[model samples]
Target: MNITKNTTGIESVILTSPDPQAAAAFNEAAFGLGARLQVRAGDAPTSGFRGFTLSLVVPGPSTVDSFFESALAAGATTVKPAKKSFWGYGGVLQAPDGTLWKIATSSKKDSGAATRTVDDFVVLLGVEDVKATKQFYIERGLTVAKSFGSKYVEFAAPAESVKLALYGRRAAAKDAGVAPEGTGSHRVVFGGGLGTFTDPDGFEWETLA
Candidate 1:
């Protein structure tokens, strides 16, 4: 049986943070993303959800500068002064909601990745109810896998060549060497339409087709 699943290409990563501005700033400098937009409550162009907003992208420095300038005018605050970092290019800004944002160009180490080619990335979701989670994926026409006595399940979509694994929140926390705060503490990679999922404990697996 075809066990591997796939999903539509992930366009970007949405990070949930208490201080999105700081998080965004750190990400830009550390990961090399340019600001895309900074939406705020009431004046926000989207529905639901409130608070500060910021986005980063991977592009040329010039483009990022112009984009960030507009974001600052819209509502974002300047965190660290935007300037060249020791690691090539980097800058920091704050979202109107008090989230910190950072942007920068990819350093050689960041861009010099040696990852294998793949069709798409996968998500490892932490769930309180494993059975219900499995059923949810099943109803969605996804494939599932399990090990004897293992409180974990794997779901894959063949069409998108993407996979999602659900595990007991506690078990996942143990595996990730984290406290399992019931929130996302692991890393979900999204780039080049291919990446892997890394748990808090640093477990990694390729999600390639």
Candidate 2:
């Protein structure tokens, strides 16, 4: 076995947009994602929910609002406004590049002040068969950190990189405040530390350089 080969978690994420430069600028302005998140130009036919979401889990409600507002100022359309929920506080938006994003926190109150930092950067893949896809990742050397039957699965990742999760496709769309129907290329890719292969849901993973 090639033990040196990584086949577990994501190292980075790339979004394909019609205007790569504008997309990269939006990311820097809204999230300050730096190099971990990237963009390239590719305008393949895609509409509605693209079967995934990028979420920024922040520290507090204040931080959530900060990111949410920044996204709006960067020309993102609001899918949901920043508001308090039973789980905490958060909001959803679609970037000009056509990527859905959620900025959120578990703290209802302010801890200190808002920052452009993230407590957790999550890539949630909306798959048709969560249980089967979860099993596929397991066989590919991904260790499950959390599992919820056929509904959801989360994989462990290095602390400095992004986290990975799986969710039901339709349910993911509902959470994103969009209709649950889309076709054509997902227009996104993952720089997984793992070697390259496409998942059951058609999400692509590339070997991290």
Residue 32 alpha-carbon offset, candidate 1, angstroms = 5.9
Q: Output the lDDT of residue 130, model 1.
A: 71
Instruction: Please identify model 1 stretches exceeding 4 Å from their true place.
Output: 1-13, 28-122, 145-150, 157-162, 181-209
TM-score of each: 0.38, 0.94
Model 2's C-alpha root-mean-square deviation from the true structure amounts to 3.9
How does residue 125 of candidate 1 score in lDDT?
Answer: 55
State residue 145's C-alpha deviation in candidate 2, in Å.
0.8
Model 1 agreement with the true structure over 73-190: per-residue lDDT tens digits: 6566665554554655445554443333444454323433322222233344555677775665455445564432347676544433334566776664443334555322222233
Off by over 4 Å in 2: 1-7
The lDDT of model 1 is 0.43
Best by lDDT: 2
Backbone Cα, N, C clashes tallied per candidate = 24, 1
Query: Which candidate leads the pack in TM-score?
Result: 2
